[model samples]
Target: MKEWFERERAVHIQFYRRQPVVFVKGEGCYLYDVEGKKYLDMVAGIAAATLGHCHPKFIARVSEQLKKLVHVSNLYYTTPQIELAEKLREITGMDRFFFCNSGAEAVEASLKIARKATGRKKFVAFSGSFHGRTMGALSVTWKEKFRRPFEPLVQPVEFAEFNSVEDLEKKVDEETAAVILEPVQGEAGVYPATKEFINELFRLRDEYNFLVIFDEVQTGFGRTGRWFAKEHYGVKPDIMAMAKAMGSGFPIGGVGVSEEVAEKLEAGEHASTFGGNPLACVASLATIEIIEEEKLVENSEKTGKYLRKRLEELDGIKEVRGMGLMIGAKVENAPGMVSRSLEKGLLVNATSENALRFVPPLIAGREEIDFAVDILSSLK
Candidate 1:
């Protein structure tokens, strides 16, 4: 372990302060460290692993794809890519799809589409919002710590107080090319946008010609008890960016656009060399199928209600917020609690200074929640 740590420090950039434990393998909701200690993974790789670790169907599908073809690039048409697009269309209700490698790339594509289609530069984002780390996405992100170092990002982007209809009213105008936000803010303590706020934003979009973009990277793909978090508001966005759980553990992301915006996009305007590659598309297709076949979205809804009820009963928690399995509990010291939980064989993480986030796999049920809540209760 010490040798591994030293090697990491010497070879890798200090991008993240990772947990002390070094996991070797995972199965279902459990992870095993080098010392063979078992841990219940309640965070699901920060909501990226939709079907948990090494799900049989997920493995089988990907293995089959690997035996045949992998990356042929966007220059050629691939069946898996088109199949994944059709699945997304059924679930996302968008007219066009643009595949990408990661959530940040998906956000970049969405930002480009918004600007090109609307022919405007200014954008409106909300406080506590985390879009992505890419330049255009970073410009819309609200955290100063994430944005300040990358000084002079894509300009003219403004921030409105989250869920504040009055502030949003003041921020948006005809000059705004787009208004981008996560329906549920994951990094900023799992705060969800209110229906009133969404309704008002769409009303403003109708008045001004700016596009509305939803960054559903963390909250999409059954994490929020729905196919996408935008469905909670019952309003369709002009553009939507998704990733995280899209291909479970595999790296796959995409941007979906409304017909109006799709018409404005030209082939040469934007392209990716490995965007819609075969292996990634099959992985995503299998992920979607697993979510559908197992009814994990329903499980997320039912089990989440139970989990929230259990969390609310805990003594030390101030409040619990979020929909479905995507949740955050307000606590006294999030990082301290996370460490303590890890010591007790439960894997959880802190989203912010005082908030502990839980985004377990969509397949998680009442049994798993009970075990997690028991650990939490004991800690409290």
Candidate 2:
């Protein structure tokens, strides 16, 4: 397997730091490697598979869609695409949405829409926010390491302190086209935005006429115990970029836009070739239905609380933060601890130098939570 991986690396780009395991199959909250060793999945493909691997409904729907149709460009309308868009509209209460192939593309679309609609060039983004790696999204992302190498990026981005209403007020001016933030900062250790801060953003948006964009790429689709993370604060964003669990394993993303913002986007302004194809659209629709019918949003709230409570009781932990199944715990030697957990048949992620992230599937139960906690407590 190592030889095979090395061979593949020769041909593919070295973009990802992959694990040593070669997974061959997945079902529910578990994955099986090539050797047939079963492991509990806590990361849920980095929170992309909300319903867990190969969900029966997800598979059936995608397989059926495959037989019927797959790729028909935006020039033509497909039923699955329209249905999925309507479902998104109902969930977000937004007038329209533009589909894409990944979270980065969604973020890119939101940035373009904000600039086009408001006719402003500057954007205000919070520190520790991870929008995406694309040029437009990367400009707003706060990490110096990711941004330094990609110099001469989209310019005139101002950084504000996360959860600091005062700093936000100071930075956002009339020239600001948009303010982009993750309601729950996933890569920055699952930090959720304070209600007070969110309220202030809405106030600023109304006062300055700049759009407020929520980068829900990682927190959407019941990851935060709600339909959308912004819902927790009772605030609506002018544009919302979402992907991750929306398609349950398929590469699909979308930007929900209010009627006002949608009106500014003229035809031939922004487009994706393979975006919103039938396969991805059907998979997304099925994933949404399964999340609703199974009541996974409520489950995320209940299970996540239980998991956080248990983690808090453990020794050698500094902080436990986040909502629903999206959780992060600060611990020593985070990366080493993650590797140890993998050895014990558990899959988790280290989002930072000291933060261990747990974003299991929405269908996770008490047993899985207990098993994961036991592994963490036993880690040295």
Task: Give a tens-digit lDDT track for model 2, residues 1-380.
Answer: 78769887999989988888899899999999988899999999899999999888889989999999999899999999999999999988778999999999999999999989999999999899998899998999999999999989998999999999999999999999999999999999999999999999999899999999999999999998998898899988999999999999799999999998988889999999999999999999999999999999999999999999999999988999999999999998889988999999999999988999999999999999999889878887
Deviation in Å, model 2, residue 293 alpha carbon = 1.0
lDDT of 1 by residue, 110-194 (tens): 9999999999999999999998898988999998999999989998999999999999999999799999999999999989999
**TM per model?**
0.99, 0.98
Name the Cα RMSD for model 2: 0.9
Return the clash pairs for model 2, or none: none
Worst window of 10 by summed lDDT in candidate 2: 1-10
What's model 2's TM-score? 0.98
Candidate 2 ranges beyond 4 A from true positions? none
- In model 1, which range of ten residues has the least summed lDDT? 1-10
Report backbone clashes per prediction.
0, 0
